[model samples]
Target: MDKAEKDQQDDSQDKMVLESVSGRRLSYDMKTPFYGDCRDVDDFKKLNRVGEGTYGVVYRVNDTKTGRICALKRIRMEGETDGLPLSSLREIMILKRMRNRNIVNVTDVAVGPQLESIFLVMEYCEQDMGTLMDAVPTPYTPSEVKCLMLQLLEGLNYCHKNYIIHRDLKLSNLLLTREGILKIGKLKFPDAQHQTHGIDLIVLFAADFGLARTLSFPSKPMTPKVVTLWYRAPELLYGDAHYTTAVDMWSVGCIFGELMKHKPLLPGNTEQKEIELIVNLIGSPSDAIWPGYSKLPFAKTLNIPKQEYVRVYMQSKPESFFHHTENAPLLSSFNNLKLEFPRATEHTLSLLSGLLTYNPKARLNVKQALRHPYFIESPRPLDPSLLPTYPEIRNQVSEKEKNRRAHDEERKKRLAHEGNDSIFSADHYKKRRKD
Candidate 1:
């Protein structure tokens, strides 16, 4: 072919390709489907932030499309180089599968303009159990406590039936709707992991499964670093890799005690200290108590002696010998569950004993706990409609806000002190010169 004909044909092909590219870009721009589902994150107006944590920031938002108030949780993607976080993915996946009255619902999910942000649209609950307990001046009656507990058990039962174990069950995670329905919230993905000094009563839903695991026969060994220190089970403290739902029951027992006393049952500063506190309150475990007690990963490595040694003189031998006690000195140790919660009934104590049983095998599962006489006898679980109503407690500032205010206050105080020091120095210099 001639050079001129070849050049003309090439130009025509290039022009057509450019036109096709332009058409595709325009189509994409016009389509603009919602970032994830119904709308972008910007579609929801953030009214105020409700809570914040390592995984996400929760905001009270208004959906402009539906004009409905909702809780929008923005999953933190900051500094994430490996793409979307596994925590966010697990939460979204789990919430999609779980559908129950007691469980919190993830209504929608949306992303920001740059796809850097992921917001989970959830059903808004007026307050969480922690906030309600803190704000409400009136304490919940035993019947009311039963009602809440039943709801929690119901939710937990559902989870267990589905093979999901909520590893981080706490008051803050149990959200309360205006209608007195308890919906679990803050379903986080598993990892290694409150203050209610005068708080009275609260929830029926288990929340915060960040460290939660699915049940498996001969469950795969997982990190023992789960559950908050206060609500943590002894098996976890002992570094037991293999565990089941019993760990959750132990947490429930702690919560049960808290409801009765309005204070934490076993508050500890460190893992060792926490173990010490548990030993002090429940008596140290022996082979009989915790069958495989010595086999725990941390048991042999513990800084403290496995058994308490007492020095005693042997009259028969006429020599000094040490009497080794297998378990913590029972005389010095006491189970103060009853002492601390004197008002709790015998049935209540029995139930608590089952839930808090040192042996994981003996510990009551959610089903057994729900059927316990403590719940069935005397005052039955109150009707949901009859649950006491309290004024919604809304914190004026988020955690970040509180910290910022504190920083400002400290800065002002430092500036004031520095100013005083400068004036004092000036006055002293003048006096010395005059002299």
Candidate 2:
């Protein structure tokens, strides 16, 4: 064939491809469907931003073709940048693999010029647990608390079965939907190739996927970083290299306490400060409760300023920091010294104490935690759909942790089919599912 004839055929294929100016390689942007494509701003016009979290800013959007309104999370890039942010990539990778009614849903992704800033499109929700907690005239009612807790535990359980852990779990991180479903978000950071803060971090949020590692059967020594310092378990406190899901359980306990009391039980300003509070309340750990604490890589050099080692620092803080207050209406007249659940159910207090236990092995994990009396005989069953007041937040699909989400989603499907919806769609995340 003549060059003129060959050029005509090449033009047809080149119409859909882009030849790199520097290299011989070619790349395809997307395959077009019957719906006509556009290079104009009408494709997706940005509305006002609804919320902003640690990693990026989120904006409400209008999808031109379907006229559907969705959320667009545009994470800020550092320099030209460290590629895609781990949190954004991790959420995408994990959410795509996980499918369940309870976990936040991730619908699509969009990229800006030269992939300058990656944009994630997600389902839209109106509120989060943190905002709701403040909205309600009353904190969570006994029944509402029971419902939220059940779902939270179940979701955590599902994640555990898949060998995934949400180091950052809090009320503010929970998204409540118009449908009344409560989901979690922000699961991708730890595994990001480019990340900051690892072993010596003060808390679990800092212990993002960037610090995440797999657990071997025989087990290997791990670090103390992963979960936030205040939510950290005692096993980790004493520095256990061979930590497991118990680390997360400890954070659950702290979060539970906050939900019940409307405040953090061990509200240490820093990891070191939090450790002292845990130790002061629980009185430090021994080998019995957390078997291999002494063997952890950081254990040999645990740096908490114990009273015995640093008496001056011990005298500085006030004791009222750990005091609990009730969820009911109160004034200056009500005693601040009382426990939040002043007349809290015996089992309720027991469940709280059990999880808040300093020792890792002894800490109530998701499995055993599910059996806790708090869920079995609480005032109500866990059901996110029941709560009317707390709003919900939607999750973007482009975060990391994609590899582990498949196992998590499969387990969620099994649980939902068995009628345990709350377990998979509970309170936490902060990446509960897709946020």
Candidate 3:
């Protein structure tokens, strides 16, 4: 009798627990149906790996349902036991909210059977600016560079306006599509006006928002090691934590210089080397030029060389003259930047200087940069459609392979020269012995 009663009580308790669990599940389902609508990663067919970064591995995939090509980015979850990385979450949240022609569009998010296997489905771009720059035989002309810069600035302007900052703005993060049309929310411009010389217009897109963040009032401290070393701003190098969009403007300046020169403007191996490069290129920063510069954490450790004083004339109601100390220790005061880019036009140089200004406060904003005289000059910005197309280098050969080949070729040439020198020395020794 006691055993039968105990078994019946246990059954009643189990039934109550099941009902409670069902009620909670129903409540969550009603609140948000996001998980319910998510598609499986298996739905898209993997084409090839396009890129791999700190946060994700990007692949060119085809949508089996629509037969449309898309870029699939799988979020990297290695050693991540907590959940989705905050950077990935921020990227997904930002991309989903932003809709601009110059910015890459995220179509959907696909998940795998496991909780960690998450992927972002985005519009496929034919080429990234970094690979194209490295693969192309020639550098982009001034007009073409202007066109690309304009699109990049437009995208950054949009992001900044929305209180977002793309901490990492490098050539690699920029995407370009073969299509020329500019499609807004519901409006599409697929007319002849968008074409140039019978070629469809190319569209530039700002992609990979992994390190992006929303700006807050009364600036907060952030990690200074964000932008790539080559494009990092001087302030960031000096350990400025309370940075702003000015950091992005500095990167744009670096990109501008790279486009004109066909190489990195400040390609340094280490942070100290990077700072030295910046100082050499743009002149040393001082408290006079950059307010609070001397107070920066890294400023005191820098060994900035002293420069000579030059006579500066000021034109006013009554002309005034004074000895102004030149800050460029390595460069002549008269040829600070002209010596670097001898072919750059006056307006172009001015724009570059404005962007790469030492002071964050004095740096050109996106709006100001877009309206610079360089864009309005004789060699105006070529239309995006007119930009030349290049073969997808990523498909042909990876960057790593190209670098390895170059290194191997150099080593072979070096070894061959050494071998010839050794042979000559051996012949001389034999002749001496015969004599």
Residues 1-435, candidate 1: write the lDDT tens digits: 899997887675444323322222122223211122224677789898888877677889999978999988876555555444333443454565568888787776566544345567888888888777766657678998888888888888887887776777777778888788887667653222211111120011112434555666657666688788988998998899898888888888887776666667778888988887766556667667668988888887765424431222212311111133122112212255556667877667666766766778767788767766677778888988788766556745658988997986676566556665665454454465479
Q: What's the true lDDT of residue 217 in model 2?
A: 56
Model 2 lDDT tens row, 1-435: 899987875674444222211122222244323111213223578876777755567778888856887767764554533354433343354444555555555565455444444555666657766666665556667777777777677776766676655656666656667766766554433333333333222121221122333334565455555566667776665655567777777777777777777766777786667767766554454455446656655566666543321111121211232123121111111111124457776556556655665455555567665665556564666466667653232333324556467767676666556653454543332135657
Model 1 deviation from the true structure expressed as Cα RMSD, one decimal place: 14.6
In each prediction, how many residue pairs overlap at the backbone (N, C-alpha, C within less than 3 A)? Answer: 5, 43, 1
Cα-lDDT of candidate 1 = 0.65
Task: Kindly list the per-residue Cα lDDT of model 3 for residues 90-152, writing each as its tens digit.
Answer: 334446556888877777666665646667788888887777788786988888888888888
TM-score of each: 0.71, 0.63, 0.72
Better of 1 and 2 by TM-score: 1
lDDT of 2: 0.54
Clash pairs, model 1 backbone: 152-204, 188-210, 189-210, 190-210, 190-211
User: Each model's C-alpha lDDT?
Assistant: 0.65, 0.54, 0.66
Ranking by TM-score: 3, 1, 2
